[model samples]
Target: MMRMRRKVLCLDWDKRTVRLLVARVGSGRMTLEDAHAHRIPAEVNTDDPAALGGVIAAAMAAHRIRRRDVIVDVPRDKSVIARLPLPPTPIAELPDVVRFQAVKELPFPVEDAALDFVTLTADAERKTATEVLLAAVRKDVLGRIRETCAAAGLRPARIGLRPYANLVSVMHLPGMAERRVLFVDVGPALTEINVVHGGRLAFTRAANVSVPVLGDDDRWQSSRLVVVGGGGEQDAISGAIHDLVVEVVRSLQAYRATESNVVIDNVIVAGHTGVETELAQALEKRLALVTDLFDPTLPLGITGDRGAELRGFSAVLGLAWGLSTRGLLELDFLNPKRVVRRSETIIRRARLLGMAATAAAVGAAALTWSAYRAKAAELADVRKGMEDLRRVVRDARDLTNRSAEWDEWQYDAVWLDHLMILSRALPGPGREVIIRSLVCDSSSSSIRVDLIATNRERVKQFVDVLADLRAGGLPDEPQDSSRPKLYRVEQGSWVEGNTAEPGFSGSTQVMLRVVDVEEFHSPAAVNARKAERERFAREF
Candidate 1:
């Protein structure tokens, strides 16, 4: 089927203004149709959905954007982003695995956040492992965005990260993917920095640095012509520029610390603060790297006086372009991809099969009735046998009363002693071994322990110590000398750690069976236990 042509409206906003871009996307092509920026009055509260949506709606109407569906962006500062190095895992299992790791690093609870991720290129040192870029936003934030959109009479088709969008627009340029580049998007209240390596986003951060917004008409003028209210405003602009440069340097340092071998080839400053030229010059001078202002119109072939204004629309343009070309974005919180567990699929299939079985059983009801008639005589005979068995059960109950006496003398599992034994088996605290959980089952006479260590060797060492304790008698007070083995290692295995930082550690779960050596040695107790086991086995 031929795909329908779509009119894409991309929207993003800051405290000061709401920016909108409209594009025609289809037929193997995407072209920018129009772009506009609507300023929000100082008195209006951006957090109020009704107030913000009115401004957004006005901007859309002025830009002639009739489409209600829009692709929105969540700024870097408004969301949480993390780079996680996970063990080798199948693509089908990535969603669960990513969530498992992301929750540990997220500032907010996973239950309250919307999550999405995209796999990045593997690290050279760990070729078999998968590296993922995880993104999360609080549900409250998304709820507000949806409310604002609803008030503006728009439906949010997808929500994307602004830093990634900026990176995407830059990567669209000729020969950009092959080179290591730093993308700096200077916004009114925040500046986002993204590092691209091997055509993938490697690092991203947002700094609190607000650029001074000059006149609406003179967006692309040089810094020399920027005349603010007074010298204080000018000093504030200069200070903000300096702070932005410092943040860029810090971001570069942070990225290098994580990836020591990477060398940034160039930097691209994008935004329409009118002082981008000066900011780019300052960055280039400070960082000693090639830095230039990002011009969006040149690549899209946008001519006329509007080219300068389009510079600020890089993120929105990228969001539109990516969604248009690719049916789905790599990371979209609105419709994040998730893996369906095999058990859930099986349950669905079982429901259908059950329906079929019910139909078959209904058809066999006549035969069942005939069989019931034939079994009537047999049922009477079984009832007579049950009466006879009842008498025998009465006799057994007398013997059970005697066995109950031995049960009182039987050695019960004392969890406190077992805990002490486990403590002795495990290494001391501050040894890089953390016991996440320890569950004791007195009925089963087993202790299950979950532990995480700094490395696989430590986990294995801990398991070996546990096994040794199971083989030898436990050390307890008063009876410590001749006490028989009180534990038997039933199950143990190590797995790659999902919570390990820097990814070279593992975790292990050990199941140990608790033994009452004293009870086993007592003949009466042994006989009683043996009888109970036999009875259980027979019943099962």
Candidate 2:
């Protein structure tokens, strides 16, 4: 089945302005369908949920966007990002590990923070250490964000950090992935300096530096006509740009001290302000690094004056791209709630399917009963003719057999449900174990699964879990003892160096025969099993 393209509205709000971008993302591509910018008055508080919601609603109405799926970029002022090294652990255990690191690194209380992390690197040789990028924002900060978005008649799906969003927006630029570069986003109130090395964020710092306005067009023309006509104004702008460059230089020096092998080759300046060109030129001369104004819209085939304005929406575009492509930054404060909602949706869908199937069965039975009654009436009339009576009996038997065959076909269609069960039976998430391949044969009433794990112990644990699930003992149900066992292990084998993940050293092959096919194939049983499996999947 072809997947439907996602319509996403990305919102970025600062003290001065609220920016909105609506786009359709699918098939590894994103198209900007509409955009809007609303300026907030200084007298009005942007933090006020009602005030902000009004502005967002106006923008959405202007753009004719009714999409409720919104991804928001929160400001960096109240959030913290840290890079930490952890002992080699399974991916499932990273949350606890990150929370521990956050407790030591963050200035605020860990209990009051919403935390997320991305794995940057894992040591394959030793399998003893891993590096991660950790991000945390206070719960209240996120609560306000949610409240504002909610008031706007929008459902906030994901919250992203602005700097990280900027990084993703520019990372795909031509020649950027191959080089270590500094991404300087010069905004109205603050400038973000991000050092990206090897296509990953190595360091980031927000400097409280605003772009300086030089003069009006007439004043600029008069100043160009005479030497030192607007020297003071020019000097002020230059001075401000110099301060930004100084910060960049300090950051570079600090980063170089730790990573001597990687050198920053260039700088990319991006923002909505018109001073970006001047700032880029000034930084190039002062820092001795090749600098250019970053136009993130270039890769999207956008040009002209409007393309320049699109530069301001880079962070929102990045957020949409991440949503479509499942980017590296897997941080989402709303993920747990989303999981619950998704499970509910799945259960509702299952119920609807069950209702439809039952209706179909009832209709089929009604038709068969009417046909049987008519055939019996005809048989009574043809009782005097022996040959006719035998033919009518044969026809009735054939119709009954066809109905039985239809039911059998329905039973065989529960293979997908069995696959769901097998998925639930495995160890997942933070565990290093993964299922490499699954092959189910309804004819043989059997399934074969190939699994990989970081070590042999995890593989053994996986087998035990599968055994428990087959015996209906894994969920600890009181009725499990009476329920029929669903599967019997037919064969098992383990091999080294048969896995794809870098840290995993071995793979296991297991084959199981379906023992209680009747219960597994029942529509109600399948639905219940699927719901339980989905719940387990969410927890892990």
Candidate 3:
């Protein structure tokens, strides 16, 4: 199937004239169909889009060009152009990194500007940094251009920088890729200089220099020099040409200072200001480099009466042809290409949402764990305080018990009553039994007695008598009526026979409990104490 051809209207303007071209692009080939230049009326305000667009609309109508979608060029002075050197980076990440760096270089706030860039050097194998051409224009400036196009009943498809357009147009010339060339486009008020190195734009700058034209009212005609046989006109033209040359030389010095190894081999000049011939000769003589006038329509076989007039149309022609051949130039401020977000795709968006949810859950779990640990620490502290209080209460109760026991000691017969009980348990005048040791502890309320006897039978008899006295079974002796009565005997009392020595065949030890005689002398108390001792003895 034959591809349908698309027609594009290219528009560019300055304070003097509005330049327009219509081209039909199809099957990778672009043909210029029509071209026209509309000179602004001296009374019409060029700054007003409504007034300027009326001239553009009338020009389009007069040229018989009906293409509505146009590609526009912003003058070099209207946009800020910069060449940024960046670290070696991948193509996918270049846009973001370039924008980040471009923000720092811009004179105005980035938010109010439209930005775009093209990478000039992106060789990963060279291990060298990447260089990109960055272009930014204020949104308000572009808005005015859009308003102008709209007023002309045209829709702007792309807004591109004029310097890059000139660069693209010049690169199409034969043998420009391998050599470094300085491209100069001289305008009435502003002149643009572009440095093309290795088929890429390296540097660009605009200067404020005006070229004098003889016929100021000659609308849409080639600019001609006024030689009225007068030195006054000649001197003024020569002075303007000299100023243009000086600006070109300064631009060359700047480019060379930065890239000393890359020497500019040729100077290509493009302008309709009839002085291009004079300017090229001056640059060649002053800078000592080959210089030539750039005719953009020549390569496309566009010549004849219209070719000379189209010398100044190189930037607009390049803007149209570059879009046709390359689909889209690297720099497109109308709709700039940016990094694609993963969240733009549904599957990637779902994954990102899942990751966010997982992070939130983990954070909540961490907070909950921290709260639990804090509460646990507080509970432990409370338990410790309770335990300390319990210890203090126990100590106070122990002190009370010790004080009551001390008071009992003052009223009771101290150790004398205990000695009397032990004497009564002895066999009369050492008849086969001998007392060995007697110990009494008033604080603990107990007595321990040790005895030696001739045989185990004598030891048994002495223990039996002590037990009987504690139970009140033995009759009190008449001589000791004032002695305290025996109240208790401990079940721990026992006798063991020792046959290791011939003199002592057995040994005995008895343990007795001291108590208040009046308090425990009742029959019921005595019987209750006897039952407890018997039960203990039986268990032992």
Strongest candidate by TM-score: 3
Candidate 1: C-alpha lDDT: 0.73
lDDT of 1 by residue, 484-524 (tens): 55566754566775855444377777787765633444579
What is the Å distance of residue 273 in model 2 from its true position?
A: 1.9
What is the descending lDDT order? 1, 3, 2
Residues 419-528, candidate 2: write the lDDT tens digits.
Answer: 65666656653468787788888766678887788888876765665565533233232335455565677546668895767888888788877666545465786687
Better of 1 and 2 by lDDT: 1
- State model 3's lDDT: 0.72
Error of 3 at 370 (Å): 14
Candidate 2 stretches greater than 4 Å from native: 123-129, 212-236, 336-540
Worst 10 residues of 3 by lDDT: 222-231
Look at candidate 1 and tell me the lDDT of residue 289.
94
TM-score of each: 0.60, 0.58, 0.62
Give the Å error, residue 526, model 1. Answer: 79
Give the Å shift of residue 460 in candidate 1.
Answer: 83
- Output the better candidate (2/3) by TM-score: 3
**All predictions: root-mean-square deviation over Cα?**
27.6, 24.1, 48.4
Where is model 3 more than 4 Å wrong at Cα? 124-129, 218-232, 304-306, 341-346, 355-540
* Model 3 steric clash pairs: none
